[model samples]
Target chain A: MGRTSDARERILTAARTLMLSRGYSALGVAEICAAAGVPKGSFYYFFASKEELALAVVEEHWAGQRAEWTRALAGDVPPLRRLRRLYESTEAELRAGRESCGTVTGCLLGNLALELSTRTESVRERLREIFDEQVALVAETVAEARARGEVTVADTGAAARALVAQLEGRVLFAKLYDDPGRLDALWADSLALLGAEESQGAV
Target chain B: MGRTSDARERILTAARTLMLSRGYSALGVAEICAAAGVPKGSFYYFFASKEELALAVVEEHWAGQRAEWTRALAGDVPPLRRLRRLYESTEAELRAGRESCGTVTGCLLGNLALELSTRTESVRERLREIFDEQVALVAETVAEARARGEVTVADTGAAARALVAQLEGRVLFAKLYDDPGRLDALWADSLALLGAEESQGAV
Candidate 1:
C-alpha cells in the first residue's frame, strides 16, 4: 500500500509540473511517466488515463489555490483589504515563478480550459466546476464589501466573474511578457471595478 | 506557381480554423494538411514548418482584424462611440461563431500566446509585436477620447493595456461558458473601467 501511494504521489507531482509549464495537449503520458521516474504500469495503477490524471491534478491544484485565497481573504480583514491581499499573493506567486522557472507559468486551469475545452467534455466539465467555486469565492467577498458599504455594484455575481476573467487574462499577459508588473495593473483595475480605492484599504 | 499559391492558401485557411478552435500546440501539421485537402509535400512546399505556418496565419488573421478595427475606430465618429462599435463587432463575431460551430472560439492570437509563449520564443516575439500593434490602436482611441473629454484616466497607455487584457480574458470566458453573456459583461465593465458610460454614444 505504501509503495502504491508513493507512485501515485509521484505521478501527480510530475503531471502537475509538466502540464503547468508545457500545457495539457503538448505533454504526453510517456513524458510524464519518465519525468516522475515511475514505470508505465505504475502510472496506469494511479490514474486510468491522461484525462483522469489531469482531472486529479486540477482538483489538487485548486485545493491549494483555494487555501491561499481563503488566507488572503481572511474574515479578520476588511473586504477591500482582503481583495488587495489576494492580488498581492498573486504577485508574490508570479515572482516566485520567475525565480524558479525564469518565466511566468500562468494558471493551469486557464491554460487547460483554453486548450481542452473544445476537445474534451470531461475536462471542460471539471473546469466549469472549479471556475464556479472560485467565482463564488470572489462573489462572497464582493457581497461582503457591498454589505459594509465598501464598494458598489449592480450585481455582485457578474462583478465576480468579470474580476476572475480579468485576473486570468492578466496572468496570460504576465506569462507573455514574463513580467510581474502586469499583475499590479490587474490588482488596481479590479479594485477600481469594485468601486473601491486601493489606497483606502483597511489596516 | 499558381497551384503552389493555392495550396498555401488552403493550408492557411485550414490552420486558421483548426488552431483557433483547438489551440496552437494541439493541432499538428499533418492534421492541417489533411483538413486543407493538400498533400504533405505541398505543405512543405509552401511553409518550412508548422511554426512558420502559424506565424503566417497570425499575421494574416491580425491583418484582417486590424482592418476591422480601423473601420470600427474610425476617427469620424466620437472615440467612445468607435470603441463601442469595436466591441459590438466582437459580439457579432462571437455570435457568428456560435451559429457556425455551436460554440465560442476565442481570439486566435490570445489563445496561441497563452499556449506557445513559454514554449517558442519566435512565436512569442511575433505575438508581442501583434499585441503592441493592437494596443497602440486602442491607446490612440483612448487618447482621442481623452482629448474630446469623453473619458478620464491617469495613463492612456496603461488603460489601453488593461482594456485589451480585459477583452482577451472576456474572450476566454465566452469560450468556457459557451455563452455570449459573459462577453456582454466584459463589454459593460470595460467601458465602466474607462470612466465612460456605454449609453452615451454619438447620435
Candidate 2:
C-alpha cells in the first residue's frame, strides 16, 4: 500500500512539473511515467487516462495555490495590501521558478486554460470554476476595502475580475519574455483598476 | 504559379483555424493538410517543417491583425476612442467566431504564447516580438491621449502594457467561459488604468 501511494504521488509531482513547462497536449503518458520513474502500468493504475491525470494535476496544483492565496489574503494588513501581497507572491514564485528551471513556467491554471479550454470540456469547466473562484477571492478583498472607504470602485466583483485578468495577462508576458519583472506593473495597475485613492502610494 | 500559392494559403488558413481551437502541439501536419485539402507532400513543399509552418501562420495572422490594429488605432477620433474601437473589434471578432464555430477560440497569438513559448524557442521569440509590437501600438495611443491631456498616466508605455495585459486576461476569460461578453468591462477598466477624468464617459 505504501509503494502504491508513493507511485501516485510521484506521478502527480512529475505531471505537475511537466505540464507546467510543456503544457497538456504535448505530453504523453509514457513521458510522464519516465519522468516520475514509475513503470507505465502504474500510470494506468493511478490514472484511467491522460485526461483524468490532467484533472488530478489541476486539483493538486490548485489545492496548494488556494492555501497560499488564503494565507496571502487573510492577514492583519489592509485589504489592498493583502491583495498586493498576492501579486508579490506570484512574482516571487515566478522569479524562483525562473532561477531554478531557467524559464518562467507561468500560472499553471492560466496556461492550461489557454491551451486546453477549448479542446477539453472537462478541463474547460474546471478552469472556468477555478478562475471564478480566484475572482471571488479577490472580490472579497475588494469588498472589504470598499467597506473601509479604501477604494472608489462601486462594483467589487468587476474590479476583482479586472485585477485577476491583469495578473494573468502580465504572467503571460512574463512567461513569453522569460522575465518575472514583467509583473512589476501589476500592483499599480491593480490599484488603478480598483480606483484606489492616489494616497494609496501607487507608482 | 497561382495553384502553388493557393496551396500555401490553404495550409495557412487551416493551420490558423486549427491552432486557434486546438493549439500548436495538438496538431499534426497531416491533419492540417487534410483540412486544407492539400496533399501531404504539398505541406513540406510550402514549408520546411511544422515549426516553419507555425512561423508562417504567425506572420500571416499578424499581417492581417496588424492591418486591423493600424486601422483601428489611426483616425480623426480621440486616441481613447480609437482604443475603444480596437476592443470593440476584438469583441465583435470573438462573437463572430463563436457564432460560426460554436466556441470562442480566443486570441491565436495568446493561445500559442501559453502553449508553445516554453517548448519552442523560435516561436517564443516571435511571440515576444508580436506582444511588444502590440504594447507599442497601444502605447502610441496612450501617448497621444496624454498629449491631449485626456489621461493622467505618467508612464504611457507601462500603461499600454497594463492595458494589453488586461485585454489578454479578459480574453482568456471570454474564451474559457465561451462567452464574449466577458470583454465588456475592458473599456471602463482601461480608462481607469489611465486615470482618465471621470468625465470621459466610462462605465
Candidate 3:
C-alpha cells in the first residue's frame, strides 16, 4: 500500500514537472514514466490515461493557485493593494529569473482546453469551472474595493474579466519571451487601467 | 525547375494548415509530407528537418499577421473605425464557433521563443523582434488616435501593449473554454476600454 501510494505521488509529481517543461499534449507517457522513475505498469494503477493524469495535474495546480491568491487577498492588504501585490509578486517571479511554475505555462487546463475542447468536453467543463472560480475570486476582489470606495468599475464583471485577461496574458508574455519585465510592464498598465483615479475615486 | 519549386510551396502550404490544426510541436514531418502529397524524399529534399520547417512556418505566419493587421489598420477607414470594425469581425469569427487562432497560443513564436530560447539564440531574437514589430505598429495606431482625440491615452505605448495583450489573451480564453462568448466579452470590453467615445458636443 505504501509503495503503491508512493508511486501515485511520484507520478503526479513527475507529470507536474514535465507538463511545465513540455506542455500538456507534447509530453508523452513514456517520458513521464521515465521522469517519475516508475514502471509503466505503475501508471495505470494511479490514473486511467494521460488525459486523466493531466486533469489531475491541472486540478492540483489550480487548487494551489486558489489557496495562494486566497491567502494573499485575505491578508492585511486591502483589495486593490492585494491585486497590485499579486501582479508585483508575479513580476518578481518573472524577474527573479528562470523558476516559473506550471501555472505560467499558460494554465495547463487552459492549454488543454484549447487543444482538446472538442474531443474532451469533460476536461473543458472542468477547466471552465476552475477559470470561472478564479474569475469569481477576482470579481469579488473588485467588488470589495468598490464597497470600500477604493475603485469604481464601469462594469464590475467586465473589469474582472479584463483583470483575468491581463493576469493570464501577462504570464503568457513572460513565458513567451522569457522576460518577466514584459509582465511587469503590462501589469502596471493593468493596475492603472483598472484603478483609474477618477474611476476609483468616484466609486 | 518549376516542378521542384512547387514542392517547396507544397511543404509550406501543408505546414501552415497543419500548424493551425495540430500546432508546432504536435506536428511531425511525416504528416506534413503526407498532407502535401509529397514524398518523404521530397520533404527532406526541400527542408532539412522539422525545426527548419518550423522556422519557415514561423516566418510565414509572422509576415501574414503583419500584412493582415497593417492592411486592416491602414485601409480607407480611419484608425479608430478600422479597429472597431476589425474587432467586430473578430467577434463575428468567434461567434462562428471554431478554435481560436495562435494569437493566444502564446504566439507560436513566443511559445517557441520561451521553449527554445536557451536552445537557439536565432529563434529567440527573431521572436523578440517580430513581437516588437507588432507592438510598434499598434503603438503607432494608438499615437494616431491620440493625435486625433479619438482616444485618451496618457501613455500610447502602454496602451498599445495593453491592446496587444487584450487581443492575445482574448484568443487564449476563447480557445481555453471552447466558448466564443469569451471572445465576445473581450471584444465588448475592448471597445469600451479602448474605443474613445465621441464627445457629446462633437458631431
Best by lDDT: 2
Give the per-residue lDDT of model 2 (tens digit) for A74-141.
Answer: 95788888888898899999999998878999999999998988888999899889889999999999
Report the poorest 10 consecutive residues by lDDT, candidate 3 chain A.
A194-203
Cα lDDT of model 3 by residue, A3-69, tens digit? 8888888999889877665666568888899989999989987888988997888888788778877
Interface RMSD of each: 1.0, 0.6, 4.7
Considering just the first chain, candidate 2 attains a TM-score of 0.97
Query: What would you estimate as the lDDT of candidate 2?
Result: 0.92
Give model 1's TM-score versus the native structure: 0.97
* Highest DockQ scorer: 2
The residue ranges of model 2 lying beyond 4 angstroms of the native Cα positions read A201-203, B201-203
Could you give the DockQ of candidate 1? Answer: 0.77
Better TM-score candidate (2, 3): 2
Over the stretch B51-78, how does candidate 2's per-residue lDDT look in tens digits? Answer: 9999999999999999999999996688
Each candidate's number of clashing pairs is 0, 0, 0
Q: lDDT of each structure?
A: 0.86, 0.92, 0.67
Candidate 1 residue pairs that clash? none
